[model samples]
Target: MNKFNGNKFKMDYSQFKTEVSKRRRSAATRELTKIAYSTPHSVISLAEGMPNEETFPFTEISIKLNDGSDFVLEGNELAAALQYIPSQGFPPLLQVIREFQRKAHAPPLWDSREVLIVAGGQDGLSKALEAIIGPGDPILVQNPVYPGVNVVITPHNAELIPIEQDDYGVIPICLRKRLQEREASSLKMPKIMYINATGANPTGTVMPLERRKQIYRIACEYNFLILDDDPYHFMYFTDEAPRSFLSLDTEGRVIRLDSFSKVLSSGLRIGVITAASPLVASIELHMQSSHLHAPTLSQVILYKLLKIWGYDKMMEHFRRIRSFYKERRDLIVKVAEEHLLGIAEFSVPSAGFFLWIKVPGIEDTWKMVMQRGVTHGILVAPGAAFMADTSKPCNAIRASFAKASYKEMNVAIERLALLIKDELAKNRSILNGNT
Candidate 1:
């Protein structure tokens, strides 16, 4: 006979077990929700990879009716706030996206490629990945890539092969070598190659036109599909913005993902996928299965705004946002030169929101900084989160100039410099057996 303890209450523990099991398969993006909710302080969050909301052009936005009159919603944009529409999204919105793509990319008969609206660039990417990638298929991604892409690829049981990249974006020579090796081994060839050609995430590098052409040539030779994720295409502050792979893609092998989030409001969560008709159809089916479609109201509102303002006005707005971020980038670069250039190395980005800093000999920069620097109210994204394998050694950290004000940016950069100096001293002392 065994005596039972009263502390062990009689309950159906199996039911709780079942619920937990169901959640184990949930998407990794859902984990961010928990982190966002739990934090109390206003996180000077450069980690989200989101654009500055303050940059959106609200002043130029005005609604007009067909009856030769001005129209206004008391709630501002009710059409964007509340509505259920098409799975493919509003036709007018798709038409506007097509026109923008045509002028921006200068593709041959760019209108031939169809546009499908999605929840966000990530959503569009996930759907396209689902439609094309099967379990165990190889997906070639640049090393130290975007975390959102990692989230999508992991759950699909896809093999993520890391392609080496530099200041000019993915090195085509390295890519060709890797592809050839994989083919020689008789292993499955990569089904797709996902690239962020313009102002890449984590690493603020833009692929030059020559490099883009080289990569396109490799894709054609290898017979692998190209997923051109170009959210920051219009964010280039430099005079020479690189041509996209989609423009060079004669075989219709490139699927371009564009987002309004970078240049507009991220809260709207609007993105579009432009590709060949068959590929677009497959992506739409996946969208139908997942979300049915992007919000109808948001699409319509954007369409109306574009119709009234035109492309030139939109480009002007983009230039303003670009100037604002370019100043921030310059400020950060100045700080790094004064405080961290010798101790750390970084590339001066021509566009986009991030500054990728490399601190050699420190494998876990996040733990070192958070355990010490977070006490000073500074935060940064660890290099490991961007890598495919977190356990592997890495010496980089990603900082942003998008969200924080100039004053805050100055303070944060100073604090980061101090943290790096302290860590470096500690490492030196250990090497000398002084600690």
Candidate 2:
């Protein structure tokens, strides 16, 4: 009987190098990849990374030219589309992204090879961290950060020192204190500062220009890198636009992560890293080794879209996306007002997909979310899940207005209100008993 097929092959299985065990791999991702590769055709698969082909914009793509001509790509064109391309990105799309980034953010120290297309914003962020931060290096972060940041820093055994944030996001004083504290304790200074400045995760607080200026100054003063993880950069619904760290950067210290996920399509898994060319080179090696490049087919698709739509038209498209999400945000806010106004105080998010609600009485929203999900089928993300300290008790929860229908949001908030009121009343009863 083989080890694999009832009759064992004579080949030595132990000859494989130990390097295979040393590479960083996600357990869930590995499982999914395994299932994707080995599953029989009869079994339906939800394990693969690729988005449903049907959900893509078109069955076939036709690009109309400016001069009443048309450029078309679909069957035959797709073969070359998947061919090996530069690890940085598709050549034409790289140029387009560079130009688009310039017109939009306009970082001062741009150069050739400064912008590289990554698989997604998370890829850009994790790879950037993995590239720079060696073992035990310290990195600065704003508290209640996007969890993806942790995935990067933890693997390197890097210390994540969180600076507490106010409603304005990343209080300058707190950041200064954290930096000074490291010095006071004789600890190594943090080499990088990772921030999700716009439409921040779970909190949705957008950093204003003044705060951006202060943070940029601190970065220059402290001589550290700034990892600007801004997936929600274009998702703002405010009257005036929120300024990005990239636009404020002067000393070439900012590595800006820009994503096409929120506005365009998450399925594309395309994002750009804008920085000085030298830093770009450092990060490029990571991509060169793993995944090699972003999906070539994705690059080709986006490039054609950009070519057809051009920059101005694409800006219009983004405006329309903003308008759509703005409408959704208004609907969610209206529902929240009706159900949760006084019970749990919350700021109306000017941009982004989430409303971060603070319930005054409750110590933590994690149990409440679970109870509601079990009893009433309403789900929300507990704010503590976003905290730097998982054990910390936070009185907040995040609700997204991204995918839920208006009626669903209304009902969900109503159920959530009931849960909060019940929790508050229960706490009061227990307190009275103790007294």
Candidate 3:
């Protein structure tokens, strides 16, 4: 044996596990594991924010290859699934996204504006925040907002100023007042105003067109960047969907994010960010450094689909998806009316995947739902997860109808109603000094 040769030694790899940041030690991470292990047979998983994969048109997908054999790829879009191509994504895909936005929003023609593809809407949001928001910079968001943005904001050391919101997404009056307050106090003005605009998360509220115009005006007045994170824009069942903030944005202050996760397949991880050329250029640079680029295969596949199906065909597909979700929403609302209306309150969502339910006398609804209701074979996302401050107690939970079948949904609703009733009874008992 040579001098340095043969002794068996165990490498000390323990240090790798200890290097996690404090922010990573979140309750959400723990809750995710718990959710994974618990199997509810009547599991109406109103928790998954993703689209129902069953609705994707498997038959319409086809891939043309240079080889003699035309591959169907499991009777699905396989060529697009297998290939690895570009970082900025395929040009054809970008064209499709741009065209989609144009038809949906009817924005004025801008020669310099373009789209930058990323992994998903969340990825785009993270990159956009990184490009614009420096550490400790104030960023404005609605009080009860999507938790995805909060996950990124916390780690980056950015201050999230929670603006109160009413039924119309992100009340314009609150935003204006907050900006004025910040100005008067010489506080750091918000660099970005993150709004869901179309269908807000948890709240299920849609902003009106007039409100969009008002928000755009305030954004211009305050000189703050407006990040319109709209994934559910196309999911509106009503004929009167709100006008996009991007269309109303005359100033170069809006960065609009769109995702195929809700409409198409979430696994593809495809989303696009549209903005002024300069801002997009910066975001592109950031993307190149971070993810290199969004997968080329997905882009190519999407381009093919768009080319064949065209915009009208795609809109019809979305309308079908909307009808499916709308029916589910109606069913859930009916159950809530029968079982939960007097006991609990909720705003009817016109579009998107969630219903925000508020239950009285229950502080820490998240803990109660996970520990109690989850054990009872029912699951729901607590409202506290959406808030920036988890220390504060929340009385609400978010219920989604996107994943569950109708029969399963009924069982879950019945179970959830019982849980709420029990909790309410316990609260009453305590107040009456019977506990």
Candidate 4:
């Protein structure tokens, strides 16, 4: 466990920031809005173009829950929802998030760090990548990473340094080896490493605490950043949730992305970026030019819900969510084992709702999934979709039990088993020149 004493080991954010991020400044109207917001209510003199709340069509918004409870937004709440808010986020929601962060991760440098609300987790991750990566810049990434990360990196023309993973998640030895091998070459070394640490997409594996510590130590030694995009942190099936990279971050090198899509509502489009203040500022500046801010209405609704739930009730909601998903995970695992025991192999997912399956004797599962699985009345995500190099063959397939019913999952796995058998038979026929 490496420890840092105060600000002595603070990371130089400038070295990790890009040239474009350095040029970004707060928008003129936004800056003025900030000043106007800071002043007393009596000193408000109109300096920017903002609409009167009275002109809006709706005077109030009401949300009814499944338990026959209603949350009404009226008066000032409705007004705030309709109007533009700060780029960082609504203050009430920020306070709730700050409290949650304190109780949960308890980041060592809480005072020096800040949080920014983005449209969603993807938006936050994209903005963070945009803030740091330039064309041809080298970046370290888990080999079979979430394709969405690649989608953001590809547009920037980043040189992705792929590090392979075992069943346990990314291997620490592989990371050190890659860095060591790259040091002797002409390729530019990576300054950023992106990972979906908990309930990782596609693989559905949770990184162990010891491995996380090793990786964090490696980051401290090599002087780089870790993009810890963890949307399924609270959905763990284990007795205790795995610690996040942010928990181990004492040097302010981890930019953690958290989302409500998996738990609350995906349509709400709300996520947070917790990082050092300078990095948060850069992402906020980027947001000013892009989406400007997350939907004010979404922020207010979430704030109202959180305020009603409070810290204790919110924690209860997380526990319920975990149990709900855990049941589904168990059901799907049982069905998969019953149907795919000898034909395919998969590890029971520890956190997220996905199961990664690999079929023996199959070079690539893409054709079976995209081309034939549909005909069989079942569809699972092809492994190639999550790979860094899509051109290469991938024998794996990602199955999700999140939304499907037990009977539906059973049927889907049965169809998959048959499909694999058909592909295997066809391959054998070709080998014997009988086709």
Most accurate candidate by TM-score: 4
Model 3 per-residue lDDT tens digits across residues 1-435: 111122122221121111222112223322332353245656655543334444545434446633232334433244334433334466557667877888887665444466788899999998877777666778899889899888887876878888887777788888889889989999988768888977789788888888888888887777777899999998875678668888876656778999999998898899999876656656665654556668756776677667767899888888888998999999888887877857788888877998889987687687679789877789999889887576689999899988998888888878888888888888889999995
* Window of ten residues with lowest summed lDDT in model 4: 1-10
TM-score of the candidate numbered 1? 0.81
Off by over 4 Å in 1: 1-81, 109-111
| lDDT of model 4 at position 261 | 90
Model 1, range 295-396, lDDT digits (tens) per residue?
866686677667776899788878788888898899999987887867888999877899999997676787776577687668988888888776676788
TM-score of each: 0.81, 0.82, 0.81, 0.96
lDDT of 1 at 54: 44
- Those runs of model 2 whose alpha carbons end farther than 4 Å from true positions after fitting are 1-71, 74-76, 432-435
Best-to-worst ranking by lDDT: 4, 2, 1, 3
List, residue by residue over 152-209, the lDDT tens digit for candidate 2: 6776677879888888788999999888988999998877888988888877888889
Residue 241 of candidate 2: its Cα lDDT? 84
Task: Report each candidate's C-alpha RMSD, comma-separated, in the order given.
Answer: 15.2, 11.9, 15.2, 3.3
Residue 137 error, candidate 2, Å: 2.0
Q: Pick the candidate with the highest lDDT.
A: 4
Q: Check candidate 4 and list the clashing pairs.
A: none
Alpha carbon deviation, residue 303, candidate 1 (Å): 1.1
lDDT of 4 by residue, 1-435 (tens): 101112433567889988998999779887666566566888966787889989899977889966466799899779989888778888788988988888899888687778899999999989999999988898888978899888898988898888898877899999999998888776687889999878888888889999999999999998889999999999988776799898889998999999999999999999999988888888889998987789999999999888887888878888998989999999999988999988889998888879999987899989989999989999999898988888899999999999988899999999999999999999999999996
